[model samples]
Target: MPEGHTIHRLAQDYAEAFAGTEVRVTSPQGKFSDAADLLTGGRLTRTDAHGKHLFLGFGPAGHPTPAESIPARPAAPGRAAPGPATAPAPAAQDHDDPDHDDTAPSGWVHIHLGLFGKVAFGPVPAPPPADTVRLRLVNDTAHVDLRGPTTCALITAPEKRAVHDRLGPDPLREDADPGAAHRRISRSRTTVAALLMDQKVIAGVGNVYRAEVLFRHGIDPYRPGRDITPAEWDALWSDLVDLMREGVRANRIDTVRPEHTPEAMGRPPRVDDHGGEVYVYRRAHLPCLLCGTPVRTAGLAARNLFWCPTCQQR
Candidate 1:
């Protein structure tokens, strides 16, 4: 699955490519046909991301202020995939937002690209929908197709807020509070490795960042969260901000330092499906970049975690 960095990048891409424009929406797979029709001629004003989820806010033609709209009803939970809940309409008397009536019903498209989900963009006159394409959005100059997403639906404004509320602060989010995660970690008995992957503890972190960050801090992945010192937690959070930011900037997960890069060590650039060079992640049995010790791996939180036994022995 793509991590928080990938979701953030996707949000930026969608904002740049389709936001503020009236785009034709369609459900090639027929699953979202009703939603496509409801949003066919609407304009997307903004795109947002929280952890692994994506939200696209829309309004009617010309996007007149206070234009009332209704949130789409949700599909059955037992259906193929789970989705977000709908928020109640803002009260008619609510005047909190002077720019427009806050009660105006509007649509919020929530998208969660699962492990196999993929999004693609191309020029105008998009080609005939591929059989696997679930949804497509086309405007004058470009179009985007989504396939296999764990979630794709039109929800209410409050629904979007509800989703955000359930998630932990994302390291990539400017307003993310590390202290929230610090408190959670300080109270949990779970391994720090497991805690990092928990969305409620820290949104957007995945197996890759989980392993690399722990290795970078010389912290054992098996250490209980409560046992990790506050100083260590601080270091862990700070490193995550730096690493996740670089991942977004370069669109890859390179975790090695200048002196340890494959080029610097006269080794060929590492190759893997996840992209970019990494230190101990997926480098099991390979020599540690720093200590020449064999990198190791083990099952943690149903995923393989890689680390250097010697370097991260602390």
Candidate 2:
């Protein structure tokens, strides 16, 4: 599954490619045909992402939602919407509000690309879709294809709000209240690693981040969330904001510090398919970057957990 940064990057990409233009929306796979029919020829007014969910806001500011224009599936329970977690700042109050335009989204296409889903973008003259594409949006200069997503539904503004309501605050958004995430994290008896992976505890953090961030801060993965000091949670939240924002900009997750880069360490760049210079995400038994101890891996939160026993000792 893609992390929050990837979804945030896609939101920016979508906005860049088609915002303000009348897009031809289609569901070649036929699953989204009814909603697509209602959305076709509508202008893509905005695009947003929160956690792993993506939202394409179609509007002239008052377009009818699929629920009103066509029969649509009920909003999926606990479904999140995609948008960047803007950096912390007082000026960003309206960053992710659906009503930022002074009115509701009018209509929204909500997408969650689970594990097997993929999105691709290219210049105009799109080829025949693979029949697996759940959604396709095209305008004069570019086209994007959505295939195999766990979600591809048309939703209303209030439904979008419900999705956000169920999610924990995302560090990538400026409007995020680190206090909110800390409140939950500071009270839970769950392992900090498990708590970090919980979408309701802190949105957008996944397995790689859970491992790397804890490793970065030398926090033991098995430590209970309730044991995490206020200062520690503040540092972790700040680090996540920086790392995930850089992930969005670079389009990859590279969590190594300046002194630990491949060049600085006199080592070759990491060669994993995950495409980032992470410290311990998938290193398994490889030597720890800092202490040279063999890294460790275990199952936690239904995903592989990696850490350096020596460096991240409790």
CA-lDDT, candidates in order: 0.78, 0.80
Write one digit per residue (lDDT tens) for candidate 2, span 30-94. 99999999988888766677788888888762443322111111122354323232321121123
Per-residue lDDT, model 2, residue 298, is 91
lDDT of each residue in 1-314, candidate 1, tens digit only: 99987877676567557766788999989989999999989887656677888877777867643322222122233443111322211222132232576333377789999899999989988899987888899999899999999999888876777787899988876567899998999998999999999999999999999999988889888888999898998898889888876776566788888888877899998889988888888889999888899999888777998988888867
TM-score of every candidate: 0.87, 0.88
Give the range of the ten consecutive residues with the poorest summed lDDT in model 2: 67-76
lDDT of 2: 0.80
CA-RMSD of model 1: 9.4
* Native-referenced Cα lDDT, model 1: 0.78
